[model samples]
Target: MIETIVFDVGETLTRDDCYWNLWADWLGIPRHTLSALVGAVVAQGLDNAEALRLVRPGIDLAAEYHAREAAGRGECLDESDLYDDVHPGLSALQQLGVRVVIAGNQTGRVGELLRGLDLPADVIVTSAEWGVAKPQPEFFHRVLEVAQAAPDETLYVGDHPANDIFPAKAAGLRAAHIRRGPWGHLWADAPEVVAAADWRIDSLTQLVDVVRA
Candidate 1:
């Protein structure tokens, strides 16, 4: 039985529309343009930051991010940014004694933002906090360490296959490919995702039955 459930942030737990829209406003670009580039990079399996580079060649993203913060425009989130099913799904799991963890590749400010939401998760952390990003073995290693459960008994759920499914499987954790968001729905039936994911689900609510079964 799955004793612990670890979730990915973008698309899996929270919709990233606001997050990226803020970026669009920050970079003075059309939202659709950046959104399109994001899709293009994901389709090509390029790092997500590549999308920004594609838009503004030679742009220093880290510096720009700090500048945006200094301008009082940085990463932000709220209940509205979350999917409708996040609370129902996680709360049900918590009631069932399943440990729920929210970890993802997000800025440290996002870590604070998520904590502010007060989601029903035992632990909420981010890549920025750990200084390691997803698709890195050490990241999953730390996930397993925090889970306090055997890798096989812990499930890592996310929308990105290369970053979430493949890496979680490689780390011996069961992986669930969530079919929402651009990455999720687009890659839902991709050969590699279909082959690698231990489970492919469309709704966070479905996780209840997943844990029970």
Candidate 2:
């Protein structure tokens, strides 16, 4: 039985719609153009960051992020940023006495943002806080420690097949691919990636049923 359900942050628990627009504006590119560029990057099976570099040379992502953060322009997930299914699903898990955690590759400020938002997760962890990120064995191990959960008893849910499902399975946890975000829809038709996940869900509501079942 799954005792702990760990979730990815961006595009999983959160919508992440604000990011593309923000980055596009910063790159001086039209939002739709940037969207197509991102789609092309995924189509070519290239890393998103590397593709961004190819699209706009000399773009320092970290520097840009820091500049925005310092200027009080950093993005935060508001109540409206969550998917319609997120709250109900999380709340259902809470009521079931299941341990819910938000563990994903995110900046240090992510924990603070989630805390402020008061999401339903019992334990919230970010890549920055753990000094490691997903697709890394160490990161999942850390999550296991915090959750006091065995690998087989944990379910890792995220939108990215490469960074989420594959790694979680490799770490001996059951993995669910949520097919609504960028990575999800991008890799939706990829048989190998789809096969790697133990479950494929289109909505967060499906997860409540998964755990309960």
Best by lDDT: 1
lDDT string, candidate 2, 105-163, tens digits: 88888678887887888998899999998788999889888777899889999988888
Q: Model 2: clashing residue pairs?
A: none
Q: Name the 10 consecutive residues with the lowest summed lDDT in model 2.
A: 46-55
For each candidate, the alpha-carbon lDDT, in order, equals 0.93, 0.84
lDDT by residue for model 1 over 47-131, one digit each (tens)? 7788889988999999999999999998889999999999999999999999999999999999999999989999999999999
- Badly placed stretches (over 4 Å) of model 2 are none
RMSD of each: 0.9, 1.5
Clashes of 1: 0
Error of 2 at 96 (Å): 1.1
Candidate 1 — which pairs collide? none
